[model samples]
Target: MDPREGEFVDRMGLVMERFGGTRTMGRMYAWLMVCDPPHQSLTELAARLGVSKTAVSTVARQLELTGMIERVPTASREHRYQVAAGGWEHVMKVQFAALRQAVETLDLGLAAVGGDRPEQRARLEETRDFFAWTERDADDMLRRWRDSREDLDR
Candidate 1:
């Protein structure tokens, strides 16, 4: 294995662990995202990630199901894996939409309070507003990120 690739995989594993994914899974995803070839065979992924091909295959399949990676077909019948372009954007959109549902739940809780507690209702409304702000700004934040990516590309 390349020493440089080892360093990259180690760092990627840490990032994946932070993001609630397995270390190898994170490393595999990271490699797929930025490797020079833009795609990796299962053997290559396993070698780089310091795991078995079967392990890489499992993680790759999971990421593929999540739309984070895709399979490329070649005339040789060998498969290569690549990180899906714009996948992070799609993931963020889905995550923010889920968060919005939490905000709605908070609103429902605020509504359940009886008429006698105006002060408590006000506080609850404030809490609800916080989530509301997040929901409202989620799209803008994603747009800004997309714009920044475009700027980087240019």
Candidate 2:
């Protein structure tokens, strides 16, 4: 690993943890992102991140479920993992779906409060509108991301 890689790993660890994942998950993800050969066995990951293989395995399973990473096929029986294509896109989709759901739930709150309660209804209405707008904005951003992604590889 490069000397600067540790800083990046630490940064990503904090970032992933902020996103409600373990620091280990972020660190492993970070390592995978910058690692040469682009995929690694569980043992390599654990040793590089200074964590247990069990911890790496657990996070790898969770990350796979989230579509952030994938288990790569190897000639040997050992499993190798790497960052998945469209991972950021997958994360945004999940988050945007939650935002859409939030808007729906907020609308229900608005209905339960009724139009007669202006002050109570106002808060829910504002929140609902904001969430609806966020979903719309996210959709637009995702479109733009798709359009420009090819350039990103360059």
RMSD of each: 2.6, 1.6
Backbone clashes in model 2, listed as residue pairs:
none
Give me the candidate number with maximum lDDT: 2
lDDT of 1 by residue, 1-154 (tens): 3678768868988987887778988888878766879988998888777799989889988788777889998777667999898777776787788777878887887878866889988888888888789889999998899899999999
Per-residue lDDT, model 2, residue 60, is 94
Clashing pairs in 1: none
Model 1 sits at a Cα RMSD from the real structure of 2.6
Per-residue alpha-carbon lDDT of model 2 for 1-154, expressed as tens digits?
7679999998999999899888998998899999988999999999999899999999999899999999999889999999999997998899888997899899899989997999999899888999999988998999989889877878
lDDT of 2 at 145: 92
lDDT of each: 0.83, 0.92
